[model samples]
Target: MFSSIKKTTQKLINLGFQDDHANDVNQKHVVNFSYLVFCFGCFLLMAMSLIPFIPIVFFVSFICICLAFIGLRCNYLGHYARAQLLMPILKMAQVTLLTLFYFGSESGFHFLLLHVIAYSFIVFRADQGFTKGIIVGVSSLLFLMCAFLSLKGVYLTESKQNLLLVSVFFFIAIYFSVVINLVMSRLKSANQYLRVLAEKDELTGLSNRRKVLADAVNIFADSVINRESCVFAIVDLDHFKKINDTYGHEAGDFVLTKVAGKMQSVIRPIDKVGRYGGEEFIILMPKTRLPQAELVMEHLRQTIASLVIETDKGIIIPVTISIGLAPISPEVTRYEEILAAADKGLYAAKRNGRNRVAVSPDFQDGN
Candidate 1:
């Protein structure tokens, strides 16, 4: 039952928005606020209909409903500025006119203008300072005007005035609560997106150098304490600069992204792969010795060598990678030492030939 209600609510919130705007946070917020206005307008119209109908009160409720429809239509047409402007205007008019002529100050209708002021800040972007200030100033002036004019006389009986006072206050409290909660939820989602951008490579979508190094340090420490084997390898694309110069930078980028994906697919779940920098990557294999790492790196080298990348101009480019492997030793005191050993082996592989894996001399004797 709860799931059905949630789906129905989602459909209403997405009403009138195009499918392309499904991920737009600001657009969703506008639709939700407009829907709230429409619902409240309906509530007021029904409540006034049930009571001893005053023509003025009924007229104001009907106008509120009409303005809400206008707001929704503006948002649907992508006129966000107009829709935002309408919301404050609608609230200010409803509260001020209602307080001035009928409900009066005793009914607390003027307090709803506070919501109008708060809504302006939430809906307007930070760059819209002038527009936001104008909305705030106008709403404030109208609030004071209602308070002063309401002192003249109230049309409703004392009992009816008290009941309306409670209802208006309750509505104001609920509106502010929902607004605050929505703001907090959006903030959390934005922070999470920022964290991912900081730690991951934008182009290749792999762990970046900083994150990879941090994880390597932690994994290395654990391996030492637990007496487990760990292997570190540095992989570099062979003749990558020539590929960029011959085909084009776009082709080079495509090759890099595809190679990263292929490496990820071949590695074990316990292994970690990251983009160390331009044309270079790092792989960490936990609980794997030098001989075991050699087989894995050799498979990766063959896999990359077999890759065929077709460019936009219909040129086919073949790619290859050279790898350097270093295993954790008792003599290794820090993660940097292991990394330096791997660097040495990478040079060895490059010197001998490309598209091959080379093991560090320090580990060759032991393995």
Candidate 2:
């Protein structure tokens, strides 16, 4: 039962969000708030119909429902800026001009205008300071106007007026609570995305040098303590600069992204692969010895050799890689030592031939 309720609520919140804007946080918030406004309009329409029917109140409720529908339609059509401006303006007009004028201040409709001030700030981004100020300033002035108009007279009886005021206050509290929760949730998601950007390579989508090295340090320490074997391999694309010079940087970027994806697909889940630097990648394999690591690197080298990339200009490009492996032995103390050994092996591989794997001489005797 709880699951069904959750799913239904989610559907309503996502009512007007199409696939293009599905990942947009601000668009999602706008859709959710628009849903709330629709529900509010329905509630008002039903309540006013059941009570002592006032024609003007019923008309206002109907207009609210229409305005909410129009706002949602605008969002569905990807007119986000239009929808954002329309919702607050329509809502403010309905409350301050219509409801407050007809039902008087006793109805508590003026309180909703105050919520519009905060709502405007949430919908507009920080960079949109001028537009945000205009919306907030207008809403504030309208709220003050309502406050002054409240002293004129009361239209409904004392009992009806009290009920209406309480209901309005209740809805206002719920609206603000939902808005605050949405803001906090968006902030958390934004922070997580920023962290990923920091740790990830922008071009190839691999772990950056810092993150991979950090993991290598911890893995190295664990291997030393448990007397386990760990392999560190440096893989460099052969003649990468030549490819960039011949095919252009766009083609170079395409090859790098494709190669990174292929390498990630071939490596074990426990192994770490990171873009160490330009045209160079680092692979850390824990609990793996020299021979096994060599075979894995050989497979990766062959896989890359077979890859054919077609550039936008209809040019075909084939690539190959050289790999160097260094196994961590009991004699190894720091992770940096293993990295240095790997670098030596990489140079040997490049010297011997571009498309081969070389093992560090220091660990060759141990293997």
Candidate 3:
């Protein structure tokens, strides 16, 4: 039973002190909510402590709860900076109140001040008025002075053993908060890196096959429903295998990377390009007609044919791509249908002699 209670208490602590959004407006709102909730708990504890006749507990808890509420209100009203600033002030007030109850800073309440200083650094980040280093240094010195005075039996008349135990509790709380914040920050960064890897091709840095296909399907569907025009294309390099055989696979990779970069440079931001498979690239252009797509593909083909790749061994490799083009329409609602239609025209371009653009017959049929 005691272990279960301990676990529940730990979960509550973790929820209250998360350290991600002190500087972000939306995130600050969430942190402010957490602070308000923690202050509510403090208010409840104050009610229980009232019987001990220590009026400072009730006074401090009341002030903290009011400040927490004000911070939350400020965040909701788009005053996030104001809300974040309140946290440090609230912690300072709490420390002062605790010191009064303990008779002096020498009563071991100085540890709570250290916790507040570190908490400010975690919450306010660089946006605060003072630097974290200065706040931490000053707080640490104050805590050490209080500790020295306590050792000499200055001011605080309460039991020395009890005050020592309170300092230990404060230390544990502050230590855990810092550790949890570091772990969470690392996890957030790692997740962002993994997301980029999932959506991009490793070699060319173009959209990977899966991501491109998914986006193409959505764009096709939207165009179909809205009666808008979109062109689907398949671009295949001519003699790609022969290039790999003569110049080596390294040259093949170099060719693919350069071609992808060239395509990106020429294409509009509204269009999407992706590596469909080995030696095959896919492009989807929204708000484009058959004639416009033909012109774009022809220009791309001519530009690629003009690019000269000179190997270190002095072998000049001239590359060109055969393009297949088709427009999305009522009959071409599915991405598979569009891809298949473009692919058919692609093979036709190869048959008619590589380095040209071919459009599906259905495009002329007005379907």
Candidate 4:
């Protein structure tokens, strides 16, 4: 039961469902839900207008409802970026003007207009201070025009010449809340992108050593609680420095990228693979026993052995990997202990002969 729960949780993490990984996935979900709400509002407006026998207003509401569905359809069809840019702008304009027409100046509908102005500014960047300034200037000009028209009895109710007063503190509080959220969300997204860069190898696009170590700690914790074994393997390409010397470093880089691709292609999704150092990669497979890990590594070795590379000189080269694997023991309490055992087995493979898999001394069969 615990194992099943662990597997489910791991699946969710892999799917980027956690709050820490919010920036990684689900960008369109919020927008889609918003659009859905707007569609419902459109239908509600249509129904409410029909009760008043308002044919023209009902027609407008029907058109707005259709446009809302169009937005939802675009979102569903994967045109998420376009939907985000266009839908809210259209909806805000439509709702603000329509509500204003129905209810005069002092109606709660003015709050919707306030929200539209806030939306315009919030959707844009705070860095666009000039653009924001222009929007604010235009909005204030329009409000002044309306105030003048209120004297001329347009878009206004009875008392607007004396009703221009507003709760300044309330507006300030709401605007501050919106601005703070926007800033924080932008900062969080930027940090996530930077963190992803820090955790990945630029050349290979695989996890860096730091990320591998982080995964190791998590895997160890899981192993401890679940009593599930994990395997760590140190993989080093044979004669990599020689390739760099004979060919240019570019050709060596070419080989490294290709080898990284191959390693990534052959591994299970649950495994963590990374460049441990120059010419050496580490593989960690949680819930894997030694025998299965060995078979996986052996296949990787054979696959890489037959791997052919061509330098710019039209010279062909074959590459092979030396792998040393060790399964975690119940007595082994630290991640480094498992890593050190794997490293020891790695040296043993190098010493006895390169291009083979070696099991750690303590984990050797019949021990």
RMSD of each: 2.8, 3.1, 14.5, 9.4
Number of colliding residue pairs in each model: 0, 0, 0, 0
lDDT by residue (tens digit), candidate 2, 1-367: 9999767766666666642323456546755675566457556655766667767667766777777777777877778777777777777877776555565765676887866787776777777789889988988888878877654436677776787788778877877787787768767777787888889999999999998999899999999888889999999999999999988888999999999999999998989999999999999999998889988999999999998877778888999999988999767789999999999899999999889999976777645
Q: How many backbone clashes does candidate 1 have?
A: 0
Looking at model 2, which ten-residue stretch has the lowest summed lDDT? 18-27
* Candidate 4 Cα deviation (angstroms), residue 101: 12
- Against the true structure, candidate 4 reaches a TM-score of 0.61
In candidate 2, how many Å is residue 22 off? Answer: 11
- Scored against the true structure, residue 240 in model 3 reaches a CA lDDT of 99
lDDT of each: 0.82, 0.81, 0.72, 0.69
Report the C-alpha lDDT of model 4 over 1-367, residue by residue, as the tens digit: 9999756634432231233544423334334434544555557557756654666557777877777667666655666555655555655455445544543344333343343355445544556567556655655554444433322324434453233223323443554564455447657777888999999998888899999889889998999899998999999998899988988688888999999999999999889999888888999999998889988999999989988877778888778889988888877989999889888888889998899999888789711
All candidates in order of lDDT, best leading = 1, 2, 3, 4
How well does model 4 score by local distance difference test? 0.69
Each candidate structure's TM-score, on Cα atoms with residue i matched to residue i, is 0.89, 0.86, 0.56, 0.61
lDDT of 3 at 104: 58
Quick one: RMSD of model 4? 9.4
1 against 3, candidate with superior lDDT: 1
Error of 2 at 303 (Å): 2.2
Q: Counting only residues 3 or more apart in sequence or on different chains, how many pairs clash (N, Cα, C under 3 Å) in candidate 4?
A: 0
Q: Judge candidate 2 against the unseen true structure and give its global Cα lDDT, from 0 to 1.
A: 0.81
